[model samples]
Target chain A: MDWQIIVDSIPALLEGMGLTVQLTLISLVAGFFLAIPLGVMRLSSNVLLSSPVLGYVFFFRGTPLLVQIFLIYYGSGQFRPVLQEWGLWEFFREAYFCALLTLILNTAAYTTEIFRGGIQAVPHGEVEAARACGMSGFTLYRRIILPKALRLALPAYSNEVVFLFQSTSLVSIITLMDLTGVARVIVARTFDVYEIYITAGLMYLVVTYGILWVFRTVEFRLSGHLRDRALDPVEALKLHP
Target chain B: MFDLKGYGWMLWEGLSITIMVGFLSLLLAMAMGLIGAWGKLSRNKAANLTATTYTTVIRGIPELLLLLIIFYGTPTLIQNTAERMGFDIRLDFNPFIAGILTLGFIYGAFATEVFRGAFLAIPKGQGEAAYAMGMSRMLAFRRILLPQMWRFALPGLGNVWMVLIKATALVSVIGLEELMRKSYIAMGAIKLPFTLFFAAAMMYLAITAVSMLGQRYIERWANRGIRRA
Candidate 1:
């Protein structure tokens, strides 16, 4: 293993990592906000409200994000005249914006499902108790339902975030010099495919494991009351045995 | 204004390749999953650690990066090792083989967890009952454990299958000429990116829809003996 090549490449890869992290954070933040309402609507009994959200989720989840990026970045060219007329051509013309748009839209769809599951998993008895205590409408959801649902959603949402981070590599295909993109450039230049890729892979592993650690800590903190403090190890062993 | 007439055959061929890769990788992934689950469940510490490391590392990296590493790096590693052994050989790695192996290996980590959870969910008494009936371990596993494990594993496996099929699209990056690649080529040839990609997206959605229906049928068959609310 050539430690020198791997060391020299870190700065370049880190440069790309900046964009990758930015892309992930921006899309996740935007997607989370969009997903809240979409998730709520997804759980609605009204077909008119729910079906559109369902379709949005289905379309995004069904197709690969790469195709979505291509369609937005390249397909938008088909409507250049219309976009130009509406003065939106500038935004669509940039690959960065197109990639970000696709990421936000794609993540929003998946996040909607995650949030909906969390929302649905909230116990009915608790909602009834809140209602019996005069909490209703927005107040009930804001005070009682949202907190519990978000807590339930956190684990799944963390997975979604990690997956989204890995997926940010796809933006490399769209000509953005993200981590994978930069790694590709270095490999092409150095012809040291294995070492370069291994370096990049390790960088990704660090980020992924770091995220896992953070989420685990968050889960431990949030579920403190749910922990059993007095469980006997001998009894646990007997149960398993 | 897209020219499907010119590229319809290419798209069809791409769809076939996509389906082929998906099914082949799914089978390979399940095999690996079974082995992984067994390893994790086994009493040996080494087997347990090996399986744990496999799942952890594979799950941590991007699938795209893994595919690239397998495609570009494996042959070089093999050839260099061969040279060091004083044997001159050149290995021509097939992209199809690379794609299937990489995808299968990546998804296998996920499938391992699914199968492991399913194995754990099965009541211990079922297997013990088989043993008490003078059945061998293999017979007990086949007759009693496998059936119940499938019932528990099917839904999770279904979700994995859905993601696996979509993942086949990623193989196009390695130049497998799958549906996504075909769309890219067609778009370049005809200059109608929207039309070609929209067609590709529809094909993917169609495949997903069909698989979902198939999953429901299998789930129904698996659950036939169980009472549902």
Candidate 2:
């Protein structure tokens, strides 16, 4: 009901959005790059390679992201001496670094499973055709496997993106001034709880739909060939094998 | 290290509350999911609109944001509105109650889709057959449709459960004495943050692993006598 309070808090909340956006993007992009190789490696017959990746994905997926964030941020402080000796303390010491690392690793683990499923979902006949053309190793994956798999992974990846964006709120518990943290601080300052929260929730709603819109557009483009395009029933039957 | 610096007992207690909250929320979610699915599948435009809006709004926001709003914002709004109407009253919610309701309401949106899919997966002929056998509508739904719907709904419901259990951790933010909160308290007390959090993480993983096993067992039972393609 108090418009003035929400109006006054806009600057701080917008500033907090910067960190929220940064955290989501950094985590998602890093997770995507790491997941590509991990996805391929997971399907390999070599137990030594696949098992570790399997364990990594299992551990991260099985546990909550909050625990992962706390473990990295607060838990790492317990090993300050060792980190200090290895020159890694500088990176682990900051809350932002710990939060970012946690987000990246958590997303990477989940995305690996999605990407692996995508790879497996890639048609067996397509792989066979690629092999018949002597496309092996890098050529096979790059030219045939990865492309189709990435398309298959898009919808799941979009879900992950929404989850990751929302999960970024967990970083606020670690003292980062992200959007949720900013809203929390304002609510504590001005007792207009509904106004502040409603504002933040609206902002989140807008961003969520925006992300979905982008994904929908991309999905349509990627899978366009699979959809029918106004062909007559008899003509469509003729095109079918 | 896993002794949790002698604070293991507290973790055990917290785990009990966490599981309690998880199940209670699951119960509420299933109830809402069923109602929402009914509204969605019904021919009434108003019911369909209401169901769509509920799922859309909840899915758009983060669970923590919704939990915080319900825990802190709801009572304030109620008090404000009461004052404007010339009534003086106070309302406060226990964090436990707030958490269960918020999570139930949030995940219910997801469960709505799952239930709707399950309902649609059943062939219309099954219900028609029930009616032809002189069964009432309610009896047909209860005896014929519901059991078959479960078989279709299991996998999606399992996914919802996994997310729900993990989501109960967010209740710690509202000061609920769940596993995550207890671990935080112990971390502050013993200063062995790594050991305490790692133990909590392992406990959570154990719960999820056990849930997965139970899910698989139930999946087998629910799917008994059905052939897979």
Candidate 3:
């Protein structure tokens, strides 16, 4: 292993880390917000609203993220004329924004399914009780359903977060200088593909482990209510029965 | 618009390669998964530790990264060693081998969890009962355990298979001539990337849907002997 080269590449790697962190954070935040409405839309009784969301999720989830990134990046370039006519080409022209948009959209589809599962897992009695208490529609959802569903969704959502962080590496192919991209550049320069890739692998490992740790901690904290409930025999019997 | 003239044949050829790669690698992945799961479940501490380490490192790294490392790094290492050993045979690493190995490495990690969980889900009494009935350890496992493990792990394995199908696209990064790579080439030749990619996406969806239906059939077959009442 070239220890000196690895040490010297720290600053460059850190710069690459900025892109990785930025892409992962932006995508996760956007995906979370987008997931709520998308999830609801997928489960909606109305075919009009639900079909588009269904198609969107199917298209995004069925294909590989790398292909999606390529389609959004290189494919958009083919439509430069159409985008320019609408004065929207500027956003699609930049690799960074295009990569970010693809990641956000792709992750949103998966997260929406997670949220939908969580929502479906909510007991029907809770909704009926909320309605009986004069808390219907948005008010009921806001105060009761959403919270319970989110708690149930927390574990799967954390897995999505870890997946998104690992996925951010795909953006490197779209010309984004994320950690993987920087590693590719270093490999091209030094011709030490093994050492550079190993270093990059280590960097990604640290980030993934960090994400896993934080999510595990969050999962523990959020599920604490269940732990306490489990300790009470009466509550357990009531919930079970 | 679709580029029928340029991409029709290419997509067909790529589809064959994708199917070939997925099936071959699934075989390798299942073998690795079975071994890894058994190793982890073994009473031996060293076996468990080795299996756990493999899962951790492979799981943590991105599949694309692993593909790149294997595709590029392995050849140079092989060639250097070959030259040093005065070997006359020229060793050129095949992309199919590289793609299969990479997918196997990644899928093995996932299969480890699925198989281990499925094995644990088997009631302990079944194995014990079989053993007490004059069956040896291996006989007990073959007769009482493997069938149940398969049934329990079917859903998880299906999900992994779906992921494995999609992940075959990563092999295109190293110019494996898979669907994505073919689409990329067609896009360059025809200058119509959106249509080509959309076509590629539809092809992928078709493959996944068929596999899903196949999974349902297998599940039905597996559950046929069980009592529904």
TM-score of chain B of 3: 0.91
Judging by lDDT against the true structure, name the best candidate.
Answer: 2
Each candidate's TM vs. the true structure?
0.94, 0.95, 0.94
* Superposed model 2: Cα runs more than 4 Å off: A229-241, B133-136
Q: On residues A1-241, what C-alpha lDDT tens digit does candidate 3 reach at each position?
A: 5688888787888899888889999999999999998888888899998899988888888888987888888888878999999998999989998999999999999999999899899999998999999997789878988899998887677678877888888887777899889988988898777778888888888988787777666666766768755334332211110
On the 0 to 100 scale, the lDDT of residue A11 in model 2 is 95
User: Interface RMSD, candidate 2?
Assistant: 5.2
The superposed Cα distance between candidate 1 and the true structure at residue A88, in angstroms, equals 1.4
User: Candidates ranked by DockQ, best first?
Assistant: 2, 1, 3
How would you encode candidate 1's per-residue C-alpha lDDT over B1-229 as one tens digit per residue?
Answer: 5567588788889999999999999999999999999889899899999998898788878888898889999988888888999999988878798999999999998899889889989999999999999999889988998889999999889988898999898898889899999988887788788988888998999999999999999999999979988
- Score candidate 2 by TM-score against the native: 0.95
**Steric collisions counted per model:** 0, 0, 0
For each candidate, the alpha-carbon lDDT, in order, equals 0.89, 0.90, 0.84
Interface RMSD of each: 3.8, 5.2, 4.8
Per-residue CA lDDT of model 2 for B1-229, tens digit only, reads 6766579999999999999999999989999999988888889999999998888788888888898888999999999999999999999799999999999999898898889889989999999999999999889989999989999999989989999999999999999999999999988889899999899899999999999999999999998999889
